[model samples]
Structures are given as structure tokens and as C-alpha cells.
Target chain A: MYVSMRKLIQLATVAFATLVAGASLAADKGLTFGMLMVGPYNDHGWSQSHYEGGQYVEKKMPGSKMIYIDKVNPADRPGLTIPMVVDDLVEKGATVIVGNSDDMKDGMREAAQMHPDIKFIHISGDDVLTGKAPANLSNLMGRMVYGKMMSGYVAALSSKTGKIGYLGPLINEETRRLAVASYLGARYAWTEVLKKPLADLKFQVSWIGFWFNIPGVTADPTQVARNFFDTGYDVVLSGIDTVEATTVAEQMRKEGADVYSVPQDYIGSCETAPASCLGVPYYNWGPDYVKLFSAMQTGNWKPTWTWSGPDWTDINNPDSSAIGFVKGSALNAENAASLDQFIQGLGDGSISLFSGPLNLQDGSVYLKAGETASDKQIWYLEQLLEGMDGASK
Target chain B: MRMQGLKRHLFEIGLILGMVVLFTTLLLSLVGASPLEAFSHLFAGSLGSWAKFSRVLNVWIPLTLCSIGLLYAFRTGLWNIGVEGQVVMGAIGATAVLRLGLEASHPLFYLLAALLMGMAFAALWALFAGWLKVRGGVHEIFAGLGLNFVAMGFVLWVIFGPWKRDGIASMSGTQPFPLELWFPSLPGWRVSPFALGLTLAIILLTAWVLYRSRIGLNLDAVGRNPRAVRLFGLSPSRYMLLAIMVSGALAGLAGGLQVTGIYHRLIPSISSGYGYLGLLVVMLANFRLAPVPFIALFFAALNVGSIQLPMMMQLDSSLAGVIQGACVLSALLVFGLRTLRKRGPSDE
Candidate 1:
């Protein structure tokens, strides 16, 4: 091949640029982290929390590079699959992979088995407990039931109608448990704390099938929230993955309806409807992610299933907490102080909410008198507890 | 003249493909990424390893079958945008048969029944749109889109009201059929060889039907000159209806295989835009059956491999869609320029 003098010089320049680029990449010894989100990163809800957690890992761990792909579920991104995403991340030097939804369970498991050296932390999936999860795979979740209970308590305290509504997503065990925990908190505050009869307090829930609207499968959460407000419910607690509850409540408030909402997933969701958002029960994933990534850095990474609760002393702590209950602007001074006292009681182990003569929706006894439910029992709750008005199957 | 035409087509294809590469590279560089690294990661994710390549083929088989079927409708100048609805209806049909728990007595019989039922359901769905287009003078595009929304609603209802697991509905989909009813997989692989073989066979059958038969010629006449079909005493509407129904049947069968072979249950996303992707593939192939499968495979590779861009390079997967659009746009532009140059001022 005959090469001109100018072509040779051009080739030399390209080679030098390539060499510099390669050296810059090799200079970073930081552990690379990859997150696969089920929704858009700026969705202002579930996926956003995971996105912030990934960012937190970079800031806290120092020398760690964080990368994330949003809207990853196959249903949303039709052509992309989870195994492909996991494989690509591993090839890009990401040793710590986070699959941020239950839908990612199968792919996370398969990826963990295929790449044993990489650590896979699947959030909110029981595949680790139910399936023979690979050694490199772990399940990380929060005891959001406590945060949910606080939301219910705040709703009950703020409600002028004594009827607090919960905008629930689907009829799953996870969703059902969360709704019932809210009911428990509502009933406790209404009957004991407020010295009112239990019969006078109404805690109703309406489910919209999925985490968000699917047009046909799930009813629109916005309309559902409107319906709850229309039906005389003064406060609506969200159990879905969107800010529709608070946003709708804010609109209704502007229309001069005295209503409040509790948003879920991200702590900053109250900013979407400051006047109507009473509080938000959100997942604080930073502490958990840092725990996993720090272990990986020390070469002592071992996959351990973790389900941590919030530090009751400081629910808003950005670190050392799995869930946080951020009081929104709508919370009044009296209710806010009571909520703080309730959190202190919860942290000191003085409160026992699950202990009961609890009945399932079918009138079957779930917990006998004075019986305390175990973690396994709570994790696999099959139906809504009695005294809650909702469909439970 | 034929030799000249062949040479021109080859030249146009090469030029368009080169332009597509150039534009996509420019896009990557503009986003502060190394175009070489991005392209390499994409290919590696799609075709580098056996497992990864299998995933590409897994998407390719259904997309190709759907595109080949679409080629039939296009030949008759009919746009079958409702293929997605047809796929959903097919899945519902298969689920109806599979939920009967007939796997133990006669597995093969039930499997075949499910496949046929799926095709029947889709054909019927497509025929409704055809009826509206012919008798009601409605546009096929609008009719097909309306039916697609109805099909989605129908699937959601079935999942929530009828086939809901344990009387509770969620996005997890229906319960899996008995293990024996599940589509047999290739040993130690995610791809179902039987499904793959069946899809390829159907594609060949469509090709033969569209290219070798008198029916294909009649459909072409109806599309190009309806007056000729009337002169031959053939009903143009009938042929148009046949073309759309066949397209729907193929799309439906793809949906059936998806439920039985891959997911083993009908979710709301059972179709997952394979019908739409098939439309893109057919367009990219210039509406020709000969290149449909190849184009479908290439598109699938782009989509499945684009995961690498997001995972490794922090770029959105939508980059793949942009590349596909650019390729189609460039090819169409080349086609327009060639036609413009070929015609003298007298033609205009």
C-alpha cells in the first residue's frame, strides 16, 4: 500500500489521541456501579430514588463511578432485555449491579449466576428467598411498612372527615401489606390517640392494578385520587409509583377542597404539591447501596439479603436508613410533634403494631391474641387484615 | 435494462448504508462518545457470545415472521397497522386453549390447537377492520388503530377479570400452564428450536404464496390497477381483505409462540411492539420479502445490542431507534433522487 506523507502524519495523530484516551481510562481505579431502572430516572418516584442512590454511592464511596440505564423493563423498552443490559455493564467494568425492581428478578438471578464475580443487588424481589438465588446475588429492600404506618397516622391526624383514603397499586402481597400497615396506623391514631370510637374512623383503599397506569389494565391514579376526594375522604395516601396522589390533591385543594396526600418512593415528592402533600414515605437506598459497594471495595463482598428499617432517631438521615418519612408542608404543628413522638416510640421498641388478634379479609385468624408476626409471616402476607375496607384476594 | 436496474439498486443500497453509518457516527461524537467504542459494544452485546446472539435471534424470529406477513399486505397496497392487536388476540386464543389443562392427555394436540386458535382469532380481528375499510369506507389505518386499543382493553380485562391469578390481578400475568404444555426449548438455551423452525417455515410459505401463486399476481393487479381486477372478474376488496387477514394470522401466531415459548403466560405486553418493529423492518427492506428477514435481524441486533450503549456509555437506548430511522430516511432519499434523475423533464 502506498501512503502519502500527509496521510502518515494524520495516522500518527490519531494513534497518539487513542493512546491518551486509553491511558486516561486506565488511570481510574474506582469501582464502577451500574443501575437498571424500570422507569425513567426523572420519573419523580420509584426509579428516581434508585437514581439518587446511585449518585449517593459515587459521593459517599469516593473513587466510584456510577452509571444507570432508565426505562429498562422489557414492557417499556420492547426490544431490550435484562441479561443484555447486565452483560454489557459487566463488560464495561461494573462490578456492583443494581436491578431496581421486582420485574428484574429473573434477569438479575440469571446474570448473577453467569457472572459470579459481579455482585447483583435486586431491590424489592423475593427471588433470593424463594428461588435458589446464586451466591453473588442478594435482595435489598426496606421495611417501608413503618414509613407507611407513619403516613397513615399523619393522614388520620390531618383528616377533617375522619375518612382517610389510600390509593393502592394492584392487589399484590407487597401492596396489600403496605396498605394494611397504613390502616393499622390510621385505626390506632383514630381510636386510641384521638379517643374516638373505631367505628367512626373510615380507612378505605382503592387499587389500580399496577405500579402506574397501563391505560386498560390499571385505572388512572389521577382519576382514582379524584374519586377518593369526591367521596369525602379528606386525606389520600399513595401506594403507587407516581406523584398523582399529591398532584391531584393539590389541584383539589386549589378548587377549595380540604384534602391532603401522602406520596411514596422519593422524599422530595412533596415539592410537586407542597400545599397538599402531608408527607411522603420513601425508600432511602443510599445507606444500603453504600454498604454493598463499600464491601466490594474492601474485597470482602459477600451477598447478604438485607431488609433494613429507618433510623427512628432520624428518619430523614441520608445515611444509615433504608426508609424515611419526610413530613410535608401540609402537616400541622400538633400532628408533626405527635409524629415525632410516634417515631421515637417505634425506634425504642415501645410500639407493637403487628401483635394482635388479627383477622384476614376472609374472617380467618391470621394472628392469634397477643401473637407477634415474624418476618417470614409479614413478608408473605396473603390478604388485607380485617377492619380495612378494600378488595383483598 | 434489467442488468442496469440491478446495478442501480446495489449502488443506492451501498450509498444509503454508508450515509447511515456516517450520520450515526457523527451523532455519537456530538454526544462526547467514541463512535468506534459504541459500535463495537453494540455488536459485542448482540452477536459476540452464544447467549447474547441467541437473545437477538429470539427477537429476530418473531419480527421476521411479522415482517414477511406484512409484505403480503403491502403487495396489495394495504397497510396493516393493527398487527399488534392481532398478536394480542392470538395470545388470548392460545391462553384459552392452554388454560384447559389438556397437556397431560395429549400435549402435541393441544399445542397445535392453540396455534390454530391463535391464527383464527387474529384473522377474525383483522377481518373486522377489513369490513370497516371496504363496507364502511373507513381508512384501514384508523380502523386498525382503533382495533388495537380494543385488543389492549380486552387483554387487560381477561388478566384482571377472568384469568386473574388467585382472583387477584397484577402485572405479573397469568399463571403458567403445566410444565408439559410449555413450549419445548432447545437443550440448555432460551430460544425454542420448534418455534424458530415453525416461524421460518411460515416465512417461506408466505414468500411462496406471494411470489409463485396466481393469487399474488391478482393482488398486485388490484393494488396497481383495480380496473384490471374488475376486467378479470376478481373482487379487489376480497383480495385486499385476504391480504390483511393473512398478515394478521401470521402476527397472531407470533404472539402465540411468545406466550408459550418465552413468557409461558399472557402479560399485557405480550405483543411488546414486535408488530410495530415488523412494520419498520418491511419499510427498511423497501417492501420486499427477499430482504425482510435480513432487515429484521439487523434491526433486532441494533435494538438488543443498544443495551450496551446505555450500560457502558451512559447513552439512551433510543439511539438505536434514531439509527434505524436515519437508515430508512437515507434509503428513501436515495430512492427519490434516483427516480428524479431517471425521469426526464417530459415525465414531470
Candidate 2:
């Protein structure tokens, strides 16, 4: 037994040596980028997709290197942080720093200040100086409402009971406004197309004050999904990590319920609940990243709070959204034909998701008769719409 | 210390066991967990999955190093809690160096800088406590704990102040170091060869020092009875100071390596309570350095596995903490019970 162990050790050492040698041979043009995640890279939500986007960048830019750090707490945003892990990136020669979370304000700022030559780009951020490019730092975000509208389309199309549920994480401006766009689309489909009363189109909404599942105390989304399905809501539309929504649909199917699901993070959830899942409004953050970096390389970079969102289209368009809506297989041929026409109409400016005269669940006037909410009004949503079951408070 | 040394073998085992159980109950009461379920949760979390096992190891590597360093305190009877602060300092030191441009050299530079700076920072932190103990009337425990808070504050300040990034203005953090500077990943795991080496090296070194040196004997004497050291012509006060410093230094080394080799930067959320956890390891080991690695790893697994509870059991991670407290308390209970039995039987 001892002899076998020795032999095994020897073999392992040789293999390790060979692996190192192979890696060394393959090490060429080793450019590195930094990805800061607020949660574990494995978290199947926002963090996971961002991580995958980093992988996508690596696959596209063969010689470039990508490094990710997860679970970066807020207090670590400043300098004394033993957890910030930014200095390590600077040490590793990262030419471009990708700050993934909103809280990385301090850590990345210090890094950019200290290393002025390195290009710094912030996503889902608001601090980048507009018009005047500061040699190195820039910020990028996208029109989330555009994608939410597409999700709204799915929600509108899928509601059999004429009642749709919107599960939101952290009821902030981003979510509130997005929810409104989604509601408008659903209302448009139910009222204008199907001629159903706006009152019949119930929008059940709830806020969990978090991005992902927190062990206890908060509502377990899967349980909530099951409860929703058990209570007769058939088509579940998810505005958060679509994984939980799809998982719930899968459970319903197992229990023999005819449930259909639409999830975000378009690709994976579709695969997980293909039969029930309609494609989610998925974002492709990579193209923007590439654009930012290429502009940086050419010394012609501008820093602005840029919001890129266009009509639902193919992946390769310049102004194309980071999010894409996957067409559902369950969408009937008649509905599918209509959905396609609506999709085109959305892009060409004929069909508006928010054709007003809208009312909140409480019968409060949201948009008076002959009034459609403009872009500015949509961007700053304050309260929950009518027919929503949960407290917006 | 053989089991046979006790006049009654089963009696001693039972006593130690009884203490452990009682202590476990105490821990449960502190956190309001059903004592029985907590231990079960802990056990399940530790042995659950490959992912959980990996998390424990990740936790263990740094914690074991800290505890092994802390053995120096037990040697001289100094209850040093400053290892936590010292670690933050070392990690900060390593981060500062890496940030400044130390990463451009071979990975060895970053590794070496982290190790040396970590030890230096810990030693400095310890020396501060030693200075206080030697100068003021302050006890080593208070001084050590004070240092921990100060060091944590310092870490927070850096991440938020000078280390702040120009991003979302949210509390996220700076991006991680470049891949080249990262301690290479073990296939299918988060383990770093550098962390593994440091943990093992500290373990071996601590064991060797404690088991094979004249200094070790001096430390043992100081611990058992400080007055005895004076009788043996050794300065007890001096030894106390040295022990605290060594303990602090070890914690610093852990902190340094954790940043440079593991997390790869000085983030504000770095400590993860390894210093306090080290106390549990030392206590669980009965102050024996050699067994500390195993115990720390076990507890680390418990923590990592608890994160899984959310994924699998839909349970909270705090449940894991509840279990850990129970295990410690129960073991202590068993210890107390055995001692009670020995004394009572004689009285009866």
C-alpha cells in the first residue's frame, strides 16, 4: 500500500509539471480584466450572468484574461479593506477594470485615481462624468425598461387567468419603472387586443427587499411560486432571476398543473423549463463592454450615463439591448403571429406599450384619458399600480 | 496524556463528553436553537457535498494558521485575541504591496511579500499589545481585543477611503487582481497551492516548536504556573510578552496570505470571524496545536455547508452557527461532568 502511494505521488508530480509547462506554452498576449461581483459568481442570478459575460468576453477575445471576485461587501468599498481585492488586480496588470456592482464606488475610484493609465468602466452606475472624458474612467448602463417591456409582452401573452404576478427584488426606481412598462404592455394586450376590462387584468406584485434568496425570514420565491400556482395563476412571469420562476413552473408540471413560465437570464431558464418557459428578456452586457474598451484603446472614449436599448432584435445590433426575449414554444400559432407583429410594431413606433388612461389597483389615475406616460415619467415610478395584491411600502 | 493515566478510563471519557453536551446546550440557549437539531445541522453541513467540503478547507487553511500561531499564547498563558486584527493588518500590507506594483514580478514576489509582511504586521500588532501589558495595567485580553477592533476599522477605512473606486457609488468593491497574480486554482476547486502550503508549514512549525524545543518547555512552565518560571530563573513577564507577540504574528500571517493568496485584495469584509473561530479551535483542541488543523477544518466545513442549507434545505446559514455553538458547549459540558464525577465519588 505504501509503495502504491509513493508511485501515485510520483505520477501526480510529473503530471503537475507537464500541466504547468503546457500552461506556460499557451501563455501569450495575457491581457487581464477585473470583474467585481457583489455575490458569489455561482449565484444563479445577476452575479452568475455577469460571470458568464466575463467568460463570453474571454471566448471572444482569445488572448485576454478575465478575473472575478465575489461577495464583496459594502464597507469594503473603501481603502483599508482586506477584502476589496482591487490592489491584487492592479498588481496583476489589468488594463481594463469592470466594476460590476453599485457599491464598488470607493474601491474602484481609488484604483482609477492611483492607476490613471488603466481604463475603468462602471456598469449599472451613475457617477461617471458626462461630456468631459477623464482620460480613463467611464460608466455604462442600459435601458432596462425596454427589456422589461418585452417581458411585459410575455406576461401579457401568457396570462390565462388574465391575472399576472410580478415578483420584484428591491422596489427601487429601476424595478418600479420596469414594472410599470411591463404592466402597460400587459394592459395593452388585454384591453386593446382582447377587449378585456382593465379590472379583469389583475397585476399581483410583491417586494422581497433582496436580489436573491436569503435563507429565512424573507419569502422563499419557490414557495411563493408554488402558492401562486396552487391558487390558480397559470402563467408565471418573472422579473427577477428567472431561474426561481422556471423552477416553480417545473414543480407545478411535476404536480400535474398546466403551468407556463417566462424567466429572465433567457438561455439557462429556457433550458431548465423549456416546455413551460417562454424566453426571458436577457441582457448582453458584453457588446457594451467591448465598445467601451475599443474606444479606450483608440484614445477616443467618453464618460456618460449611457442607456442603450432598442427594439427586440438579433444579438449583433449596435444599439441592441443587453436583454433579449426568447419566443415561447407554447405561444399558439395565432398568438405567435400577433406577437411577431407587435414586436415589429414596438420597433417601428406604431405600438406603444404604455397607451395611457391607466389606473392603479386602487383606482388612482396613473395616466388620465388621452395621456401616455412619456420617457421621463416612466423613468421615475413612485408607487405600485392598481390590482396589485401586496404593499408597495 | 494517555487515557490510561486516569484512574478510571470510561469515567474520564464520560466526563469530557458530558461537558461537551452541557456546553452544547448552553450554546443552543444562547442562540435559541433546539440543541439536538443544531448539532445535526452542523454534522450534515460539514459532510454534505464536495462544494461544502471545499468551503470548509477554504476556511480551514487560514484559520488553522491563525490558531497554530495562537498556540504561542497558550504556551505562555496569554489569552491573545488580537490575532484577528493582526491578520487584517497583514492582508492590508499584502494588498498595498500588490496594488503598488509588486504583482508585475513573478508570482513568488507577491507570495513572499505577503508572507513576510503578514508576519511583520502580526508581530507589530502583538508588540503593541505587549507594550500595553508591559507598560500599562491593561490585561492582554482587552488589549488584544482592542487591537482587533482598531485593525478592523483600519481595514474598513481603506476599502472605503483611499481604496474607494469610481463606480456605481454603491458599496460594492474594487475588482479582483489580475489572473496571473491570483494563486492558481486547483482543478474543480477554489483551493490555492499557496494557502495549502502556508497552512501546512505553520502546522508543522508549530508542532515542532511546541514538541521539540527548550523554549517550548519554558512556555509550558509559564502556562502551568507563572511563579514557577521565576523559580526556574526565567522572567515570566518577558515570556508573556513574547507569547502574545508570536500569537499576533501568526494571525497576521494568516491575514496576509488570505488576501494575497486567496481573496487577492484588501476588502472591508475580509475577516469572516476567523479570529474568534480560532479561539474555538484552540479550545476544542484543549490548546493542543497539532489537532487544531483538523478541528478548524471541521468547523470551516460546518460554515461552508451551512450556506448550502439555503440551497438545499431552504434553511438559513445562521443555523450552522447555532450547531457549532452547541458542539463546543457540549464538549465542554462533558469535560465539566467528568471532573464533577471524579470529585464527587471521592467526597461520597
Give interface RMSD for all predictions.
Answer: 2.8, 10.6
Q: Which residue runs of candidate 1 sit more than 4 Å off their true CA positions?
A: A1-33, A59-67, A94-96, A110-119, A131-136, A215-217, A251-256, A290-304, B1-51, B101-113, B131-139, B176-190, B230-238, B316-345
Per-residue lDDT over B103-194 for candidate 1, one digit per residue giving the tens place of the 0 to 100 score? 45888778878888998999899889888998999999999999999999899889888898884567657775765887876654657788
Question: Which regions in candidate 2 have their CA more than 4 angstroms from the true location?
Answer: A1-31, A39-45, A59-62, A70-83, A103-115, A129-136, A311-321, A354-376, B1-271, B284-348
Of candidate 2 chain A, the 10-residue stretch with the lowest lDDT total is: A75-84
lDDT of 1 by residue, A228-247 (tens): 99999999999988788888
Q: CA lDDT of each candidate?
A: 0.83, 0.66
Candidate 1, residue A114: the lDDT equals 70
Candidate 2, residues A83-127: lDDT per residue as tens digits?
Answer: 224544554566778877654544556556656777777766556
Model 2 Cα lDDT, one tens digit per residue, B55-152? 56777887887788778887887778887788788778777766765447677676677567777877888888877877896888898889888987
Q: What TM-score would each prediction reach against the true structure?
A: 0.85, 0.53
* Candidate 2, DockQ score (0 to 1): 0.06
| Model 1, docking class | acceptable
By summed lDDT, the worst window of 10 consecutive residues in model 1 chain A runs over A73-82
